[model samples]
Target chain A: MLKYLFAAFLISICLIVGKALAHYIGFFPGSIYGMLLFAAILASNIFDEAAIGAAIAKIINIMPLVFLPVCVGVIQYGDLLQTSGWKIVAVGMSSTLSVMALVAFICAKILRDERCD
Target chain B: MNAVIEPIIFCICSIAIFFSWLQFHRKFPFALFNPLLLSVISVVLILFLLEIDYSRYMTGGEWISAFIEPGVVALGYPLYKQMHLISRLWRTLIGACCLASLCALTINVLFAKALGIDEWAIRSLATLNITTAIAMETSAEIGGSAALAAVAVMIAGFTGSAFGMLLMSVLKIKNMRAVGLAFGSASHALGAATIARTSMEASAYASTALILCAIVTAIVAPIYIPFLLSL
Candidate 1:
């Protein structure tokens, strides 16, 4: 129990610092900044991965749960969906598929050639 | 529902519905049966049918939603675990991720424009290829609706998870490394997890791509999206 709390405390601190840094940098969100800072700390060996292992696992496990409300927030945009649903679907499908194909094709060519050479 | 008890009711109901769907997805193991997508649909229908005000439901929903940013921050752990692998393939991985980020942004923006999508929706659409938390925040930062961005990310993730492998087979992308990178870069975590079931090596590559692509897109989308919007 204490371990979980400590891990949460560490992450919260990172988040607060990240938000503060984001206030000045103005490029990305504080959450993302927090993620980077945490990653850097972990990479630098300041804190053992085991310290936060349980907390990280638990948080990630419920990630989809956290996203539910925001997704349901789409209810607020019914008018937008009604007017442009098909266009949104079309753009999303085509772009996602094309990006996948492009990345796969290019990476395959390069990586395979490296193996052959 | 009593006014005092309503929020708790909605919150508990949401969790119950989500867990039920999660179990169902586990049994079926089908992409179309995604727990998150199913849970969202179920909740939306429940609210609509009951004529519950979205705001009222949100009083409880906000409690769960508050964890989203912290959840994203936790993603750092997985990325950190993969640093050794990433460092070995740094050149190829970084180059592919940057290209993937650029490609996804340009295509989404240009296609949306060609389809006559409004600027606001287009901004949300532009960040669809990344993870939800980052995508939502980035979208709002760039004058888009975070809600719409979440919707767009869902669409992208669903499309990739459901059709990614089929598309790869059709396109004849045989290399597993490429497969992993494509799924990670284009589809984010959902696609990566789905592909992870088949090949651990590919999953590793996919996970690396997922984080790298998110970082790349988060940085590039601010400047590049506006330029694409202008054109």
Candidate 2:
């Protein structure tokens, strides 16, 4: 459908612009750069609010699908996981918990003030 | 050319991808096991076992990757709707980001060493609270284990939500924004996705979480790693 094509076309442009900016900035991932690009396009009135809205809708709808390629990458590296099963899980779980708790504590302290007035 | 005869394989792989993702959506979803991680690993193994090189595999995966463009492009809508929330909380966001990044990084370093884990192991453990891909890259950049980083990100999501909610109840925290940001920053995309599933407000927090986490990590990793390594 034309909608699909429009979606694809816009994404390609954004991604290209994103990749370019990321290259120039010398840090941050290209995709993150693209998100910034989309934000710029939205803010600058270069892309229609409606069109970008429609595109964003499609992207979120299909997010689960988009992750397909990387899912396979995990499987490819299964052996490393299998061999180091306990160690990876142990370390992964501990770090995840500690970091998550720490971040949560900071957020609760800093952002939880209910003072957005 | 022998290379030209690869669409047949690409076609088959795409179907596998479609199904695996579909199964992922129905079962574990993002809140549980990140199916994308599984899908990528499986595809890579398939290609390696079948003697298909990266180019050919990408030829197959690229067809699927086509969707990634539209998906990324389409992310603007939620962002658009959530613009108000972003504007009102910009200042607090800055403070929260800095605090979260420092506390997260410091606790990770100290506790990891206290456990007597190796530096490489700790390094891998360090970046796991981010999304798998970013975690992987963070892992690679610091010469840590990328898979370990992925697991770390997942663990953060799981425990962040479970304990984060419990702690909020005990602490009598009612500020939705803080709850969302906490879950998002610590848990990254997975936590964000979880909020998206639960409520629009939560989703906004998650979006902020994603942006803030990225900002903080990009800032913190460089400074933190050197300090930790030196110690």
Candidate 3:
């Protein structure tokens, strides 16, 4: 659909702007910066969701697919993984669990006033 | 075959496997055969066995990559949709995110350092808690490998989604809010998806946590990581 393509076009424009801004600002990646910008625009109602509804739907459905290239890019770093795969996995897994426990405990402690039924 | 066409072939193969495996994944619902992970493995194995050069494979890889930025930019829509919920829990969510972000970065960095991991790898590890979209970019921005961070993000999401619920029960955390927050803040989309299967409220809360934690990390990591790495 034209709307789908249009939505992708709009996102591409945002991505360019985001990249340019990041180039100058030297902060987070342009992708995230652009996403925030798009979010702000959408929140402001400048771009009605209905106009781009189809695209938004597809984007949400296949977000993981978009990242496949990045994942596959790991093949280029095979040597690194072969040497330190276990360490990366160990560190990654531990930190994830620590975050889960820490956040769960903190949120529960804070929201203890309202109990779930 | 011409050089230009190799990328086209690569693209077709990668996308074919990805979509086909996705269908298989949905029917089977096995974590080990995650569509993304499986596709990557298939591509890697094919490329290795066939003696395909990384440079040529990237022809198609680069094509799909064009969509990645726009795909992430589209995240704004969901964030916008969840704005109401996000605002309602603003105070509590911010606190949890601050703590989560600080702890995620500090613990991962320090643990990796203790193991004497390369500094670049440690930098990539710092983006572990956020979604792959933000993590890959943040990794590169902070002088780490985007590729490595993507893999790390998937690993974090897979592990967290698989065990997060178990951890919550063991800790006696019955609050769905806490449970969802832990899943999203720690695991990203995969964790959010896992919780979504349990309840709507938890899923909503999980998405908010996922988006909020990502934004916080995107903003906080650059300023904080440089300082942390300096030490």
Which pairs of residues collide in model 3? none
Model 3 segments more than 4 A misplaced: A114-117
What's the best-to-worst order under lDDT? 1, 3, 2
lDDT of 1: 0.88
**Comparing candidate 1 with candidate 2, which one achieves the higher TM-score?**
1
Q: At residue A5, what lDDT does model 2 achieve? A: 67
lDDT of 1 by residue, A1-117 (tens): 877787788789889999999899878789899999888888998777787787777767767888898889889989989999999988888888998999999999999966421
Off by over 4 Å in 2: A64-68, A74-84, A99-113, B1-16, B19-30, B37-59, B62-81, B109-125, B141-148, B161-164, B170-172, B196-199
Question: Could you estimate the TM-score for every candidate?
Answer: 0.95, 0.76, 0.94
Candidate 2 residue lDDT tens string, B121-164: 67776766665545655555677765456556666767665566
Best by DockQ, which number? 1
Interface RMSD of 3: 1.4
- lDDT by residue (B100-180, candidate 1, tens digit) is 999999999998899888998899879899888889888988999887898898888889999999999999999999999
Across residues B1-231, which tens digit of lDDT does each residue of candidate 3 receive?
688787888888888988999999889875666788888888889988999877778878888877777877988888887888767777888888888888898888888888888899888878988888888878888889887998888888889878888899899999888898989899988888889888777787788888888889989988888787777
Query: Quality of candidate 1's docking, in CAPRI categories?
Result: medium
- Alpha carbon lDDT of each predicted model: 0.88, 0.62, 0.84
